[model samples]
Target: MSRLLLLSPLLLFLGLAYLLPLSGVMLQSVTTPEPGLQNYSAALGDPLVWSVIWRTLRVCLCVTVLAVVLAYPLTLLWLKGNTATRVLVELAIMIPFWLSVLSRAFGWLSLLSNRGLINSWLQSLGIIAEPLTMVRNEFGVVIGMMHFLIPFAVFPLASAMRSVDDRVILAARGMGASRMRIFWQIFVPMTKSGIVGAALLVFVFSLGFYIVPTLLGGGRSVMIAELIYLRIFQIPNWGLAAALSALLMVSIGAFLVALIKRAGVSTT
Candidate 1:
C-alpha cells in the first residue's frame, strides 16, 4: 500500500537510530556481566535504586497534578475571553514551550536562590530574618518542572474545552443548573480524554527530565535519569547503567498500561 511505503522511511529511521541503540542497551545490561539477570536482580535488591525510582515517580506526579491545576484555570480564561485576550494568553503559554530547557532551569535557579528575586522581595518585606531555603531541593525541581509542563497541559486542556458544545452549556444553564454544577458535570467529563492525554504527556516527560532536576535538585533528590547519568559518567558502571535504563523502560511500559486500564474502567 501507499501508506506502507510512506511509513518505510520512519520505520527505517527508528530501527537504525532508536531501536538499534535500545537493543544495544538491553544486550549490554544482561550480557556484559556474564550473561545473566544478576544486574537486574541487584538493581532490584538495592534500596538506593528504589529510592531514586520513587522520587522520580513522586516528582512527576506532583508536577502533573500542579500543571493540570494551573493550566485548567488559564484554559478556562482563554476559552471565555475575547479574541485579543485569548491570543495573548496562548502566546504566553507558547513562549515557555518555545524556550530552551536549560535556560528555563537556570532562570528558576536564579529566582529561587537565597539571594534571588523572590527571597530578596520577602527579605525586604521583613517576612523572616533568615532567608528560607528554596533552591537545590525538591521544591525547586517541582517549580521548574511545572513551569516547563504547564503549557503542555494547557494546550490539550484548551483543545478539550473547546471541543465542548457551547449550546449544551447554555441549555444546562437554562434548565436551572448552577454554573459550578454545569462545569463539574458537563465541562470536566467531556474533557476527560484531553486531561488524561495532557497528564500522561507531562508525567512521561517529567520522568525523563535531566537538566531541570539536576540544576534544581542540588544532588539531594536523585531521580532515575540522574542516577543513570551518575552510573555512566561518574562511576563508569555501564552494566548497571544499562540495567537501570532497561528497568526504567519496563516500568514506563507497565505504568502506561496501568493508566490505559484505569482510564478504560472509570465511568465517572
Candidate 2:
C-alpha cells in the first residue's frame, strides 16, 4: 500500500503525458472530417500507401539482416578479446549513438551523393564517366539506416551471447565436434533469443525512421513515417494522418508484446 501511494505520482504523470495525447490522436482518427472508418479505408485502399509500407518493410528487413551479419564477428571479437580490444570495439559501436541522427544522415549524404566525395574520387581515377546516383534512393536509405541500427543489434546480441554457457561449448568440442559444426549447431542455437531480440529492435526502430530516409532518400524513397508527416503538414489531411498514427501505434504495440513474450520465454 505504501509503495502504491509512492508510485501514484508517476502513474498520474504517465497518464497525463502519454495516455492523454494518444487518446486524443485515436479519437481524432475516427472523428475528424466526418466519422466512421473512412480514413482507414482510404489508407488501405490507396495504392500509394501500400507502396510506401512495402518499401518501408523491405528497407528495414534488409537493414536488420545486414546489421546482424556485420555485428556477429565484432560481437565475437568483443567477447574474446583483451580489455583494451573490448574497450576499442565498444567505443566504435557506441560513439555513433552520441551523435545526432540528422548529422549522420547528412554525413552519408556528403559522401554518397552524386558528385560528392566518393563520386569525385572515382571520377578522378577514371573509374566512371558519369556520376552515379547513390543518394535519393533505396540504396542510400539502407546504408544510412544500417549504420545507425548496428549498435542496437550489437548490444542485444552481446547480452544474449554473454548468457550462453561456455561449458556447453567445451562439451561440444570434447565430443569432437568441428568448429563449424559447433558454431552452427550449438552456439548459434543458444543465441537465437538474442538474435531475435536484436532483429526486432532494429526492425522496429527502422520502421519509424524519418530523418535518415528523408535526407538520404531525398524524397524519392518516401517511407511510412515521412508519408505520415506529409499527410499532416503538407497535404493537411488530418484524418488520414491521425489514422496512420493509430496504425503505427498498433503495429509498434504488437511488436512490443511479441518482444516481451520472447524475453519471458527465454527467461523461463
Candidate 3:
C-alpha cells in the first residue's frame, strides 16, 4: 500500500504525458478522417512509403555497423588506456551531449558541403579540381546520424567489455595465444552482448532521427520520420501521419523490449 501510494504520482504523470498522447495517436490512426484501418492499409500499400522505409532501414544499418566498428577501438581505449587518455576519450564522447542537435547539423554542413572546409582544403592541395557533393544526400544523412549515435554505442560496449574476465585473457596468452588470436577467440566472444546491445541501441536511435536527416539530406534523402512530418504539416494528412507515428512507436517499443531482455540476460 505504501509503495502503491508512492508510485501513484509517477503513474499519473505517465498517464498524462505518455499514455495519453500515444492513445491519441493510435486512435487517430484508425478513426481520423473516417473510421477503419484505411490509413495503415494505404501506408503499407504505397510504393513511396516502402521506399522511405527501405532507405531508413539502410541508413540505420549503415550507422549501426559504423558505430560498432569505430566504437570498439574507443571502447578498448576507455578500458585499457591511462588516465589522461581515458579522460580525453570520455570528453570526446560527452561534449556533443552539451550541444544542440541543430548546432551539430550546421557544424556538419560547414565541414561537408561542396563549398565547405574539407572541399576547400582538398582543392588547395590539388587533390581534385571539382568539389565533392557530400551534403543533401544519403551519404550526408548517414554521416550526421553516425556522429550522433557512436557515443551511445560506446557506453554499452564499454560496460560489456568491463565485465570480461582479464584472467581468461591472460590464461590464453600463457598458452601461447597470439594477441590477434586471443582477441578474436576470447575477447570478442565474451563481449558479444555489448556489441549486440550497442548495435540495437544505435539502430533504434537512428530510426527516430528527423532534424539531422532534414538538414543534412537537404530534401533529397527522405527518411520515414521526415515523411511523417511531410504528411502532417506539409500535406495535412493527419490520418496517415498518425498511422506512421503509431507504426514508428510500435517498432521502437519492440526494440526497447529486446534491449531490456538483453540487459536482463547480461545481468543474470
- Best of the candidates, TM-score: 1
Please estimate how well model 3 matches the true structure, expressed as its whole-model Cα lDDT.
0.91
Off by over 4 Å in 3: 254-268
State which candidate has the highest lDDT: 3
Rank order (by TM-score, best first)? 1, 3, 2
Query: What is the overall TM-score of model 1 with all chains considered together?
Result: 0.94
Residue-wise C-alpha lDDT for candidate 3, range 43-111, written one tens digit per residue: 999999999999999999999999889999988998899999999998988898667889999999999
Clashes of 3: 0
lDDT (0 to 1) per candidate: 0.90, 0.90, 0.91
Q: Candidate 2: where is the Cα deviation over 4 Å?
A: 125-129, 255-268
Query: Of models 2 and 3, which has the larger lDDT?
Result: 3
Write model 2 residue lDDT over 142-210, tens digit each, in one string.
Answer: 999999999888888898899999999999999999999999999888888888888888988889999
Give the worst 10-residue stretch by lDDT in candidate 3: 259-268
Between prediction 1 and prediction 3, which has the larger lDDT? 3
Give per-residue lDDT, candidate 1, residue 67: 95
Once superposed on the true structure, which residue ranges of model 1 sit more than 4 Å away at CA? 265-268
Error of 2 at 252 (Å): 3.3
Higher-ranked by TM-score: 1 or 2: 1
